[model samples]
Target: MLPLLVVSALAAVQSLAYEQTLGFNSAPIVETRSLDEIYHAALAEGGVVTFWLGGDEKGDEDAIKKEFEGKFPGMTLNLTTDLSKYHNGRFDEQLAAGHVYVDSIAFQTVHDFPRWEEQGALLHYAPVGFDKIYPPMRDVRAAYYGILTVGWAGKWNTDKLPGIAAPIEWEDWLRPEFKDKLVLTYPNDDDAVLYAFDLIMQQYGKSWFERLLKQNPRWVRGTRTPDTVMQASNSSWAASFTSDGLFPTSNINVSHPVQGSFVTWFQLAAIPKDAPHPEGAKLLHNFMLTKEWQATRGSWPVRSDVEPPTGYPAIFEMPGTNITYFREWMSDRAKLERLRTWFEDKLGSAQGLSPLIDGI
Candidate 1:
């Protein structure tokens, strides 16, 4: 619906034209084509509909691919991780050639859509159910929508940071007592954490960061790092980054307004302009935004018609939840890159990383 009609072209393959058929009533039927028919046309016409997915959810990718192939026979899905590391070059090389090899791309970098569109690397392809998309999501040009909205929050030992003055605000992280006792998630590898760090720097400035850096943070490469550190009570304070998780049910406390710290949206998806099988891509996109598929994907549903995933209360946009709006951070890529550099220069070491309790 965003008309993410990104206008980019591909070289490895040729485009296939197929008759489209909507399962709609009151509409004159010209030619309605199922996803299978379109896919077959792509294969028959000498093009492979490649679906590229990025993230840790390999299982979800498998399921999505499975469902897609089930619906559209002969289609192929190619999944990969570490997208952020090479996303810029990966697409740039393909796009600059004036003949790209890849078609649709899915990543957690919500900002990439606008940037790519600006670069004229995206294609516009309106999916089947554009009107049903939520307003916030509709504003974006990319047709692909992320099934799960992510949030940047914190996890810590309540027993350690006890009292009304919870370590909710970024300022709390700099408390003299809390310093030298914190272990946050990795930032360089995970932009979601980097986005949250950007908020801390934006709100508090260098002095605050300098002080927090003194406390030391473990720069481990894992989303579960915070959970691992907090669950063991290794650090009295820690940074929790999660797109999907339950804090209440778990023993560790994840502060969402118990004090401060804003939760920001982390990622989104978009359909490609030169889709070998645009029909299948659109169908899969529609299916993902639907309640039925979200339940299986294990993330917040974008549709108001769908209930939040069981046991979940709200998303990054909900009221009382102060979100930094990761979209804002996308503006200054250099600054983010520098922030990552600063984190490494200041706190990515044994001496800089907070150690577990001495006895333990």
Candidate 2:
């Protein structure tokens, strides 16, 4: 016989499954309100919604704010953009003080969502296209779901490095010709960037890390800084990982190694259980998943029904890509902190103001 506690836990799991089958745990799944209906409902409940977005750019939410407000006039969308690490800490403070101010959040810190759900801080509501979302991208209980996917790959300037083939192998950047011409984001500064470095280390060992440091890459604080530098012809290539959209005219080209590891993860979103404007929050959440918004997103949408932008395949369809690795790595706080500290010890500390604040 199983231990009493173990038996009870099994029973609880069975009960939840039974409830889900009976539609008792499916409010969000069964939602029938149209976006217009939700918008009207939001207006009825005070037409304001405050959202917190996790990013290294303050202007990241500008397009979102413009589209959201344009689609639903008379509604105010107060969106704040900042680093996910800072947002999560401030959110915890608000929850502890019982004064939750923000209505919703979309962040890169994938591990924080589960913690919030466990604390009953999240609203267990699904957006309109929840079922259309990829299986691994959403919570079964509808607590939260991935909004979009962000990826880091090798990016280089075509103008600066004229005849060089796209650097699709991890070892390509370490070549003698590339020395002192690489722009790198400090892995200690961003967990996603750290995960990318972790993948490379796992494949090639610590000696690879030492060799990378020997290349004497110009270190920057934010991942976006590399792209900025490369655009100005200040750097020939980004270190190992970087993010950008596909475009025909762009001089910078993004590529992933054909035979080594890379990193990508969904930027997850959820509403607060104690949101001041619950109706408005629901409206915004559903609005984000609609075809209108998803089509315009630079990153791939979580919905399987939505087509990826031209020149890029759906993330799941892409080879050598797995979203779960980064999430799992982030959840292991002990291991993550140890590796982060080790990197900091070797690189000293990240320097300069946040890219968002400094406008770098």
Candidate 3:
């Protein structure tokens, strides 16, 4: 048998070698090169890339294809938009068949990314702006990076509420006058909404939600439904509406929670280990991180240098923003199911909203 010290040293070296192979450090596996250089290399390697993005809307996919093709002439981008649940399932099938088709993936299924990384299904190729990304937003192992920050906050219609001051905090929504006039997405429907509810319970206690339930607020299914109801003046307020910051003319106004809001989930992007077009994936990854692309995407960019759109603060600057890592909650399947069941008992059954969009 080997000496104990020698055995320990060998084990350490093996672990270090494994991590180095995965490119766990921020330094990208691909050499530091300009987009133009990467593009040329991609052209040499069949100039075609495919991505699976989380969303049901074809418009976003078309927009990305158009923009990418326009920016880098002669290259082709094929993107598929579907619910993250469906996308993840498809990826599993592809992996099982030993024929992975997608070059890159962007999804709200943040929990699965780590699993894929561990399985060696993901490629650790940091884009050009990886170093500039928020430290919290990037993976410690450099396997993936959060490309966007999407938030859920309180939304109220000015026309419907008239003279009442808008809610500045989650507690304000519990006020007696706002009762019955509020609409909320079922807490068990979306992870983001669930996270928001969890934060509210943590800060205000279970009694707060019980009292709010007593108000008989209308409960809806999808995140979009609450926004739709508010915009049509059907509801005075919504507890968890996606604040896209595009509704300037509409009476619907979003209020950032003063006690901090839950970041629904960041859209994490990564290249697959078996990607048929890695050079193209690298090119696309670096391109998406550029200020021009990130600014136009309308979501909160992860790069520190990229400024958020007008009227929106950077993720770090947002007060009381709870950007806690949610891997624990995601990994604990039994606990998550129990939590969902508990909420359903209190809040009633969730309307079966299609998870095809945003996995909400």
Candidate 4:
């Protein structure tokens, strides 16, 4: 049996305990200001906002900076991008020091938001489009909301394997021809990637993991590296999932497997109660929900009114996918850490620079 003890405690966010937790207020403080009004208020409060964004690459901050600044002139955004695992610890440390420097946070560590809310650390203000957001994607109290929805899927390079099948299944990569041709992000390093591996293991068991280890897949840090390696034609397949999606002209294709579940989760964002520039933080949160921003995220938007990326259905509407389960999985940190350690023991420690340093 697959460690029933380890997975037994999985709980959904909408469960009564979460919705009615003791000492944690679930009442929302909805924001009534228009984006223009919020922007002007931000300008009066030093016109600067700093967000500790979660990502592997420093370069990921560029586009967001351009967009946020262009939309609200005179307002400056100091956005820092790093792994959420590290960012969460830093956030906690800052709180312990009684100085929360960052104005906002968009992180993948879904569990932290609730803990912060209970500690009375997060601002209870909702963004302008809070009502329009898919209910499950927003915190009941509106201390945080999912800003973007991202999914992970198997990816392979058609150019490298000319006769390869389309929409390759997770098991397909284990074939003899694929030996040493697969690249994967370490499950220990990224929660989304970790959840993807956990799903596969649940379906296929430890025997499957043994077979995979025999294949000698190259492991790296960060979810972006596998796709980057495949794009450069350095690897022909990725048995592990990649967050990148399909493009019309690209030879690389993302697999939405019919035989197994793929993982998707919302990237949650919130403003801190102790933000140095509270007005600017609120402005940035509201800006994220704006149609201009939501439509261009290249992933599913939390708001129902926005159109999804071209040629794809909304993530929740997609078949062979799990959103709620991933949320449950992320909420249980102990289970995640246990599984992460188990995978590391089997796959050996991850080797290589982060995609950020590798210039992906």
lDDT of 3 at 31: 48
Ranking by lDDT: 2, 4, 3, 1
lDDT of 3 at 184: 74
Off by over 4 Å in 4: 1-27, 233-240, 246-249, 358-360
**TM, every model:** 0.66, 0.89, 0.81, 0.88
**Stretch of 10 with least lDDT, candidate 3:** 238-247
Candidate 3 structure quality by residue, lDDT tens digits, 1-360 = 999866765654343324334444444484489999999999999989998898634453578888899999989998888767678999876665556789999987788887777666777777888888888778865789987666666677777666677777777877776777787777786665676677778888999888888878887765566666666534455333443343344566666766645544568899987899999999888988888888876567778899876777776676767454564466666777788888988777876546344343
| Each model's Cα RMSD | 9.0, 6.9, 7.4, 7.8
For model 4, residues 1-360, the per-residue Cα lDDT tens digits are: 556533333321122123335655657778888889988999999999998888887876689999899989999999899989889999986766666799999998988888887767788888888888898888878888898777666766667766766645677768886687777778877888888878888898878878887888877788777766777744455334556453423676666777788877888899988899999999998988987789988777889899878888876788778666767788888888899898778767777776678776
Please report, in order, the local distance difference test score of every candidate based on alpha carbons.
0.53, 0.79, 0.72, 0.78
Best by lDDT: 2
User: Ranking by TM-score, best first?
Assistant: 2, 4, 3, 1
Give me the displacement of residue 211 in model 3, in angstroms: 2.3
Question: What lDDT is reached at residue 282 by model 4?
Answer: 92
Off by over 4 Å in 2: 1-29, 233-240, 244-249
Deviation of model 4 at 121, angstroms: 0.2
**List of clashing residue pairs for candidate 3:** 260-320
Residues 1-360 of candidate 2 have per-residue lDDT tens digits of 899866765654343222224445434444588889999999999899999998888886788899889999999999999999899998876776666889989988889888777666777887788899888888987889988777667877777766776677788777776677788888899998788888888888898889888888877887778777777744455333555444424566677776787887888899987899989999988988887688777777788888987777887777666876677889898888998999999998999899887667
Q: What lDDT, from 0 to 1, does candidate 4 have?
A: 0.78
